[model samples]
Target: MHVTAILSHADEGGFTAFNPETGTATQGETLDEALANLREAVELYLEEFPMATRAAPFVTSFDVAVHA
Candidate 1:
């Protein structure tokens, strides 16, 4: 099954990956590593709690004004 992965830089180092579908998160040294880790985590989570329906999550972004 296909899932969404959100990746960001960690405060300390490396990258942090999160799967919105399964609510799974993990960290890795690189983008590839982060994605791989997220995949494994999502797989394990699914094995325990399978999703009843598979729907692709709608992802989008918006700009927010920052006031000084």
Candidate 2:
């Protein structure tokens, strides 16, 4: 099954990866490592709890006005 992954830089200097599909999260020292970790986490989660639906997440952006 296809899934989405969100990656971000960690404060300590590494990278963090999260898969919203199965709520699996992982981290690594590099982008490639982060992605690999995320993949492994998601796969492990799916091995025990398979996906029942194929609904994709709805991601959007919004702006909020703020005064300095």
Candidate 3:
């Protein structure tokens, strides 16, 4: 499944996680590292959530636009 992750670092230096498909967002010290952690999170979510066989998991695709 394709998932979109947005990461931000807290003032104290920690990571946050969110799913674009679910319109959720989180934070991390670094985007790349946060994304990697989020990958594991999604898998764990799936394992915990459970679903029917042959049922495709939801895919989340996203784009980040910054206005300057």
Residue-level lDDT tens digits of model 2 in 10-57: 999899999877888999999999999999989899999988867777
Q: Residue 63 CA error for candidate 2 (Å)?
A: 4.3
Q: What is the lDDT of residue 59 in candidate 2?
A: 70
Q: Rate the local accuracy (lDDT) of all candidates.
A: 0.93, 0.89, 0.65
TM-score, candidate number 3: 0.49
For candidate 1, write residues 1-68 as lDDT tens digits: 77899999999999999998888999999999999999999999999999877777789889999999
Per-residue alpha-carbon lDDT of candidate 3 for residues 1-68, written as tens digits (9 for 90 to 100) = 55556565666787777865444454557777677777776777777775344544556568999999
TM-score of each: 0.91, 0.80, 0.49
Indicate the residue-level lDDT of 38 in model 1: 93
Task: Report model 1's TM-score to 2 decimal places.
Answer: 0.91
TM-score: the better of candidates 1 and 2: 1
For candidate 3, give the lDDT.
0.65
Model 1 off-target regions past 4 Å?
none
Q: How accurate is candidate 1 locally (lDDT)?
A: 0.93
Candidate 2 — number of clashing residue pairs? Answer: 0
* Candidate 3, poorest ten consecutive residues by summed lDDT: 50-59
Ranking by TM-score: 1, 2, 3
Candidate 1: count of backbone clashes, pairs at least 3 residues apart or interchain: 0
